[model samples]
Target: MTPSRELWVVLETLHDVTYFTPEARAANESAGLRGFWRGYVATRAAPLGAAGLGLVTAVFHNFAPSFLARSLPSVWEKVSPERALAARLEGAVAALRAHLPEPPARANELLRRAMDGLCWDGRPLGAANAVLPWPDEPTAALWHAATALREHRGDGHVAVLVSEGVSGLEAHVLRDAADGSRELIMPNRGWTDEQWTDAERNLWARGLLDGGGLTDEGNRLREHIEHRTDALATYDLTEAEFAELDGQLRPAARVLVPGAVPHPNPVGTPRP
Candidate 1:
């Protein structure tokens, strides 16, 4: 993997623990956001401060609109955005503390440096997360930094897809074809069979797909998108800085992979 993609694997693992851990689920439930999807939508969108459905759909850039509609505006009624944000942070910290009692202080410091003065234009999710008050505890701070940086990368990824003329469903279809994980992706993203078939037909028409796999052109496009995303996510960190941060975080990721964060999962993070 490229240095930037490798960095994303570890950072995404750290940020994702919040969504999978029982502690996070309970926290969201206690805050009145019940069910996995409800908690998922609320916590992720909470950073946007009561974002509307249209805003969430635009920024998130994936997920069936109807799927998101099930939990969005209604979730705000159950719990305020402020409460959802607090619940997610609390749950993430709790989950992290279970696996890592002592925080990686140096890693957190480097992350903060990387995120400082980041350009927020066209990266709303990352920008919103970056501006949140840093938690007092070291573990919470680490998770917070990971969350912000990952979202920064994710926002850039969405831009790449948009520029490539890949719709939300088409993006997933291409990803599944490339990774051979359609079963997991399609259901989780809430795309119906008809929708998936239509997307596949569209890709076939564009010569990006054939017989449930990416064509050579499709692979090239996917690679270009990934390469551009890595560049956009690079920020100002020097090679040495990235190497040091990787060294600090890789150990925790090793422990978390396929444990705290499952492979072949909906988030599309591969095993590092």
Candidate 2:
């Protein structure tokens, strides 16, 4: 099949590789992003803030909005930029150490080069620019590289969603159906039953969904999103580099592929 263009494996692998790096979790909590918000919201103070919910959500995908809603806004109250970048970097560095402990000598170089290749002019649209002013660290640099690339794809994704006429929540609903999973994003994402019903009606009326499920067209559209996302994500890399990256990244991902940790597959990356 000349490898899949959807690159779903590569996409999930990269996202999972970064997110599941055990130390990243520890770093986030110790730094107070997770602990401050989830552990004790009252303790979150003025100095610890972020850009906004949308920026946070786009970069930090796979998190439930309700969970994000709790900590993000409180943290985003004042918007201290450097600290925000460091908080995310901490976990990624930890994961890199835990995973790529041996020196590729040029791993950071590879990541940084790719990061430099990203186009980040999307101020109103993407999350990468939020930390544009910050300097890069080696292992942490990998995370920033991935974050920038991922957010670029994300910005393009929102454009695609709008182009397809799929509303935000409706896109989520359609994804779940197209992927054959029925889990709602979390009741805390600020959607009501009526709103959801209305989304369903719109999808059904347009024949994208049918009989309480995604129709063939729905699956096609969802697949289109997935493929387009992968294409955008890998846009900066050559085929050889991407193949090498996919191989290099799969090991860290494999560590967490099964029942490997406390939350078990928290990154939600499937095995290749």
Candidate 3:
């Protein structure tokens, strides 16, 4: 994919906007979503929730499984996953409404109209689009839009990762290398020493790493995937429109990001 300033601006800015969304965070926490999702997993027939969040597992793949395990642990009998998730969404969208009035009317109009121009074939709709329940509140609608778009980029990213031959665990390991951090991912992923070693061994064979860590080629490959992911996400917008979208979201991001600290700050996001 060709380089695109517009794509990076739109993708990264909107992504950070969601991360900083006090509404969703407040809702997720208040609803005890950790327990909800964990409980959802605990209740499922085959432990599918424990199977991790599908594509999301990769985005958060570097974190130790223990952290996720603790937050979304096995507690099946207490609650239904559906009920818990709904509670979280309701409360969070309420906050979004409180923070920004009429999000659906304006934010939705701008972003969704832009979205309408894109091709949706073959792309899997994720949690954000599981339902078409558009809230009357504008900020809630904006949050919904953000989730859908971010998930779109994320789904595309997984395809890129798969095409490039990076497994879930291997993607985790290689990213750890690129970040120059050994301490962050190893234990979190719940892999035994043997598991970690094998992942690195595979990475070595791929010529993406060496004794010193991520080789130059590895760095470039990581960067390329991210670039491709961003470009893929902005497929619907012209350079000017993407910039307009970024400009629209930046002030809101600025207001919300600071109070939204102690986030995971994964290697992929540049420091705001």
Candidate 4:
């Protein structure tokens, strides 16, 4: 992987503590978001300030719309977007403090620099997050920076998927087939068995899948999408800067993998 991609993997682990950790979930529940899915949707989408279903569906780009409708707007009704953001940050900071070593001062500074250079055009999630006030605590600031960069990469990935004519469900279908994780991905993203079968048929029509796995054409398209995503995620950091950031974050990521963050996760983040 390129340095940019490697950075993304490690940083993603850091950012994801807000989603997967007990502390984050507890915070969400305490804030009046009742269930896991409701908490998940509210915390993640809170940065968008009470976003409606269509906007969330378009930017998030992978969840089943019906699944989102189950929580959104209603989630906002239960807890304001501002409160949701605070809850997630509180949980993420608590989780980081419990798990990782204190990040080096320089590491946090590098992440801030990376955030400063982030290009926000067409990156709705990233743009919204970038505008939030940085936390006073070092750990919170680090997580916030990581979250912004992660979403920036995510928004770019969504763009690549759109450009490739891959719908959210189709993206999951292709990903599961390529990575051998259909069982985990299908239910996590709320795609029905019928929807999955139909997506597979669509891919077959496109010559992207067969009984065994991804056809050669399917493999090529997947690779292309990933490469383009990497290109878009590449920040203005030097090779040396990326190396420094990776060295700092990789240890914490290793600690989180399979403990806080699961391997073969629905988010598609690999173990660092």
Candidate 1 similarity to native, TM-score: 0.96
TM-score per model over all chains: 0.96, 0.71, 0.71, 0.97
Q: Model 1, residue 259: what's the lDDT?
A: 69
lDDT of 2: 0.53
lDDT of 2 at 89: 59
Choose the strongest candidate by lDDT.
4
lDDT of 1 by residue, 1-272 (tens): 77878888889999998888888988888999888888999999999998888999999888998889998788888999999999999898888888887876599888888888477788999999999999878899999999999999999999999999999899988888876677987777788999999999999999999875889999999999989998888756788988888888988877777667777667877665
Cα RMSDs, all models: 1.2, 5.0, 5.1, 1.1
For residue 179, give model 3's deviation from the true position in Å.
Answer: 2.2
Which prediction has more favorable lDDT, 3 or 4? 4
In the range 1-272, model 2's lDDT, one tens digit per residue, is 12333333443444444344456556556655554344222121211234456655553433445656776566654334455445555555666566556424444465556656656564232343434543455555554554555556666667667668777778767866655433435353455667678888898898999886888888899888776655555445677775666666556545544423223232334465
Q: Which stretches of candidate 3 lie over 4 Å from their true place?
A: 1-76, 94-106, 125-131, 186-189, 261-269
Model 4 lDDT tens row, 1-272: 98888998998999988888898888888899877788888989999999999999999888888889899778788899999999999989988888875865688889988888878999999999999998878899989988999999999999999999999899888988877688887787788999889999999999999998899999999999999999998777898888888888898789988888877676778889
CA deviation > 4 Å runs, candidate 1: none
Clashing pairs in 3: 64-188, 64-189, 65-188, 102-138, 103-138, 103-139, 104-138
